[model samples]
Target: MRTTYLTIAGRIRQELTEITQVVERVQQIWQLYTSTQPRGNEFLVDATALNLHSFYAGIERLLEVIADRIDREKPMGSAWHRELLQQMTADIPGVRPAVLSPETRTRLDRYRGFRHVVRNVYSFSLDVEQIVPLVRHLHAVDAQIQRELSQFADWLEQAAGAE
Candidate 1:
């Protein structure tokens, strides 16, 4: 049976798959970035930074889809990225529970800043120091998002079943 929860959850699930792909690709890039000797491996680092940028981009895309589809609202203005993340932590009165926690919000906020830097600067200009923590901690955010979304999906499935 078709239901609102199924439709919403279906799309979010597809997004999680896309994020998994980004995670795989980012992992490969990180391996290349780390294994190569730092002395002569500008290319590897640059590749990693680009992929890191993509990682955040993919997550933002997923959030945008969820915001538009389930929340029925798209943030407006120059700071929409921040607002969208904020929205995820909010409980919309008649809509749905917050999709993620405030702690996740704090972590994702860093990437939001990183994403901005990646966009505004050249890849070669990326600082290895800056990218290091993001790479190191990527899996934590990935897991957190996966766990949160999975629970949401279960809730959605139950809602669908009830309907």
Candidate 2:
């Protein structure tokens, strides 16, 4: 049986909360790094990498739920992650509007790529330069995602009530 729209909306809100937590942790790590800049702590750098990974992972989790429940299908294969992201930008006739804007998808793709690198490499090997940009942009990305997904959730809730 298909999941109820309200149920999916609740899941989306929960994932948004999780993503916010991840963003907060990443901000903390960035602040710590800046305070001790010249010293360059490896642990802080590694923590940043992990939190960044979590941020993208949370987003992917939200998208996966939408794709499965609302869209009625999830992409497959080794490139499914990228495929799923792409899928969210397409407005499906008679189903639902696009879950993400193209700009949001583009911004998210950066985190997705970073998550891939973090997964394959040793935390110690993570470059501070790479982590810096993602950390700086985290807040903006978080805000955009929160706005987009919350709007989507609102739509789901309305659809649920009408059923």
lDDT per residue (tens digit) for residues 72-162 in model 1: 8989999999999999899887677888899998888888898899889987888889888988898999899888887777777886787
Model 2, span 21-130: residue lDDT tens: 99999998889888995866889989889999999998999899889877889999999999999999999998888999999999999999999999999888888889
TM-score of each: 0.89, 0.95
List runs of model 1 lying over 4 Å from the truth.
Answer: 1-4
Q: What is the lDDT of candidate 2?
A: 0.90
Highest-TM-score candidate: 2
Per-candidate clash tally: 0, 0
